[model samples]
Each structure stands twice: as structure tokens, then as C-alpha cells.
Target: MRKKRRYIIVMATCILCFFGIIYFIVPKILFYTQMYDNRINVAIKNATDIHDLLEEAIHCIEKRQYYSAIKLYQKVVQDYPYHKKTEGAQHAIGSCYEWAGNYKKAKEAYNIFMKKYPDSKLAEICRQHVVELDNPIYRKVNDAMVDKPEQLDKIIKKCQKIVNNSSGQKKTDAMLKMGECYFLKKEYLMAIEIYQEIISNYPDYSRIREVEQMIGVCQGLLGNYGKR
Candidate 1:
């Protein structure tokens, strides 16, 4: 049964990766990013050992309900310690934390996973994650922004460097962060312009609706400020 369950999990991971945005899977729940295709849903549902907690956790992740998903994944680990999917559950807790922008907690969770599953196939991946998170540049911009939010210009510059260096979804993410910095700085016109660029350049961005909403809000605010 364990072997069968492991095989199912591995196969599902492969399918999800091939079908979804492949560049980054660990940071986002794999199947969740692909618009929740019915086949993925069916596969998860059919995986009997992963019935409720893991399945629901994936749903929460799809909805960007990171904390909720973290709880569900933690439940899977705590309540079913010996379950075939426990390693995945443990790893997912870190992924949820990373997606939620809690890099410190994500690193801690990955470290715990490495310790618990030293010989598991995911251990090497966890080690890579640990190395990635330890890099100050990866989290510095966000962390500094949080520490000195009034320094919006500095943060935007940092985000711009990220945008300049990255491509595809990574660039989209950096652009969104830069737009957010503008919005927070009350530079409504600038925020709207950035958001518009995102709409134009990255039509397939997953958070398109949210980006549109941000633009709308910026426009309304600009009008109120007599800048429109």
C-alpha cells in the first residue's frame, strides 16, 4: 500500500509539473497554479491516503489561503505521522510559508523537513531550498521594505533590479511588487501605469484580476486627489 501510494504521489507530481508553470513549483503548489484542472482534482480525490487534509490543503493553496493551507498540511503531518504522504505534507508546510512571504518560517520548516527525512528523496531538494533562503538578496528587498516602509523609493529600486534581471513569471512578480510599492507610496498614477504595463505584457498572470482591481483603486484615488 505504501509503495502504491508513493507511486501515485510521484506520478501526480510529474503530471502537475509538466502541465503547470514549470519554472517554480515549490514556491507555489504545483497543481494549484494551473487553474485547477478537473483531472488534477480527480487524481487528488482518488489518492485515498491523501483524502481530506492534503486535498483540502491544496485547495487552500490554490485560493492563496496560505495560513489555512499551512494548518491543513501541519495536520496531515501531526495526525498521520506514518502516512505515505507525510513527507510531502512536511515539505508543503514550507512551501506555504514561502508563498505567504514568510521566508524565515519557510527556511525553518525546510530545515525541519531535512532533519526528519534525511534519507528521503526530498532531502536534497530541501538542502537546495535552505541554500536559496539563506541568500540575503532573495529576501532583503522585502525584508527591508517591511522594516522601513517609508523608504518606498529604495524598495521600488530594489524591485526594479529584480524585474530587470528576471523574466517570465519572476519578472511579473517583481513588477507586481514594484507596483505595490508605488501604491503604498500614494503614487497613484505611477501605480496605475505599472499595473497597466503588467496587464499589457503579462496577460496570463495568475493574479490578473487582483492587478486589475489595484489599477481601478489607483484610478479612483487619483481622481480624488485631482490628478486624473
Candidate 2:
């Protein structure tokens, strides 16, 4: 799975580079950008070619060939945004990423749609999708945009949902995050308890080492270093 993810990352980079855009990632931040300002080259293709590509891409999408559809959609965006189905293509591009297991990229694509066609009928619908993507349980509460205590409480509730409703590795990751959330709020005792619960339940999970480190950190913060 990791290799496949890395391969897709490499391919995504090459595809974007082929058309003069770049995708960069920062481990701790959300940023997505692509530029196609003065480089739109419609003069090289006749009108009929754009139409054909649009139809073909739509066909590919219906066949669940989203990668090819995305390439076709990118071509239309770069060569012919004036195409009648450009907005639909943009929406489809976002859907492709969502289908392919990268909600972050899907959000970025949907964001592009919102920026490019804010008044479109799909704009509000896409914004709702973005909110769903940012539900905070999928990541940790530390990654949430909480500038206040109340906001932190909201994040805690969402993270707790993941702990309660999920199972397997998903539940484990969320449980660990639940501890991290408490730790962030300076609730060291609760954080320590959560970490200990994880250790007891998931002794053989892959992230046990990280969980142990978090447990130690929480203990240290509570001034219990000598107890260990």
C-alpha cells in the first residue's frame, strides 16, 4: 500500500509537471496551488478536438476510468475552459481523487471548482463536501483549526466519535489521537489514561512505539518521571 501511494505521488507529480504545474506537500500545513494563467493554448487545437476530448472524457468517467478522465479534464482546463462541460470536468476531477482515496487532494480539487465557478449551482454542494472532508476525526485534534477552548471541545467530541465508532487500526489511530487532543489541552491525566488504554488494547499494533513515547511524555508533563 505504501509503495502504491508513493508511485501515485510520483505519477501525479510527473503529470502536473508535464503541463507546467507543481504539487508540493508540507507535513504540517494545508496548501494547494496550480497556475494556468497566460499559458492556456487553445490556438493549437481546433474547436472540434476540444469537443471530442470532452465527450471522450465523459465516457471514460462513466466507465470508471477516472485517471484517464482526469488527464482529459486537465487538457480541457489547460486548453479550453470555454468548453461547455468545463465545470463538470472540474467536479469530476475532484470526484476522481475522492474515489482514488485522497480526500485532501479531492478537497483541493473541489476548492479549485469553488474558486473558478463560485456562482455555479454546484458551488454550495462542493463547499459542503469540503466541510465533510475537514471533519477532524480523520486526522488528530491537534490538526484542527482550534483557536479557542470551545473549539477544542468540539474537536474532542469529534475525535471521541472515532474512538467509539471505529475498530481495528482506524480505532487505534483515533484512540491515540484522543490522547493527543487531551495532551494539547494540558489535561495530562486524561491523556495518560487514554494512552494507557491504547497500550493495553493494542499491544501488537504498528504504532505502539509512538504510543509509548506519548505515554512517557504525558507522565513527564505530570511530574511523574521518578515513578517510572
Candidate 3:
């Protein structure tokens, strides 16, 4: 009787150990497999959705339906804020505003993107737009030089100061405006010199063709039309 009792106890302990291993180890492995499958499915679904939205938005933009494109891009930005497409969505929003001729809103959107992603590749493009929008003072000075020719020397001096102090597009515009001031003052030689400086030094400037034309006009005024 004592031997039978001991045998029964040993069998019970062995059965419990087997059940424990099955319960803990088997379920843990199954759980991890299920979790990985779920994650993969979710990633695939998200990727599909992102691709669809981007394609639709691009199509709308190509059709010149800027508002529709903006709406889709906004959805992309809101839904996938942490996705890589978010930055592109932000840039597209700015472009949409610009295409719609909403310059103020475009500027605001671009400024926001610049502030958030200062080191992004899009930052340089946004900076260029901002520079173009913010040069009202330069435009005003150029207009004053054209409209009020009696103050040509004073305007030229002022524009030269701006050129010396400013950089990038602002400096280029100031240099061009200085040349205009000289042209209005009938200082054709000085105007040609400034225009040549711009053509050589600021090749990337937007006014390159206009400066070339002005240089030709200055040459003509100086009786050097044959050179032109």
C-alpha cells in the first residue's frame, strides 16, 4: 500500500509539470506569432492607404484642381502625421495655396514648414518663396527710382547700400535697381557696368534676361550698338 501511494504522487507531479510547460511556453510562442502577423498586416494596410492618397493627390494637382489636391494632402498630413509623407504633404499644401493664387496663405504655410523642418530639403525652396514675397520695399524703391528721376543719384546710393548689406535675392534685386537708377540718370556707362557685374556674379538671379536687355540698351545709348 505505501509503494502504491508514492507511485501515484510521482505521476501526479509529472503530469502537473507537463501541463505547466505546455501552458506557458506554447502559448507564449503562439502569442508572439500572432502579434507579428498583426503588425505586418497593419503596416501593409497603412502603406497601401498612403500610396492611394498620394496618387490621388498628385492626379488632382496634375489636373490643376488645386483645391481638391490640397484637401487630399491635408488628409494625408492629418492621418499620417508621423509618416514620411507628412513633410511632402506640408510642402504640397503650400504649393496648392500658391497655385490658387492665395499668396498670403501660401506664405503662412511655407513659414510653418520652415519653422518645423528647418533642415529639410524643402526649407531652401520655402526660403526662396519667402524672399520673393517679402521684397515689397525693394519693389517700392525701384518704382520710386523710375517715377522720380530727379532723385536718381540718391536712389542709386540707397540701393547700393542695400546691395552691400543684404544677401541672396534681396542683394540681387538691389543691384539691378541700382543699375536702373543709373540708367534713369543717363549714366549709361555706369549702368552697363552694374548690369555686367550682375550677369557675371549673380547668374542664378531671376532678372538675368532683363539685365542683358538693359546692358544692350546702355551700349546703344553710349554709341556702342555695334558691340551689342
**Alpha carbon lDDT of each predicted model:** 0.71, 0.65, 0.72
State, as a TM-score between 0 and 1, how close model 1 is to the true structure: 0.42
Q: What lDDT tens digits, residue by residue, belong to model 3 across residues 1-228?
A: 999999999999999999998999999998976775464444434556765666556555444556666767777787888887678678778867765656678899899988978987667777776676567864455446545667788877877899889899889878877886776677778888899999899987775755775675466456564244
Residue-wise C-alpha lDDT for candidate 2, range 107-137, written one tens digit per residue: 9999999999998766765786688668765
Instruction: Give the C-alpha lDDT of model 3.
Output: 0.72
lDDT of 1 by residue, 48-154 (tens): 55456565665565455677778777767877899876876788788678667798899899899989999876676667667767888756764555445677787
- TM-scores, in order shown? 0.42, 0.38, 0.40
Give the higher-TM-score candidate: 1 or 3: 1
lDDT value for candidate 2?
A: 0.65
| Per-candidate total of colliding backbone pairs | 0, 0, 0
Return the lDDT, model 2, position 24: 40
- Error at 168, model 1, angstroms: 19
Better of 1 and 2 by TM-score: 1
Cα error of candidate 3 at position 181, Å: 31
What are the clashing pairs of model 1?
none
What is the lDDT ranking, best to worst? 3, 1, 2
Deviation in Å, model 1, residue 195 alpha carbon: 28
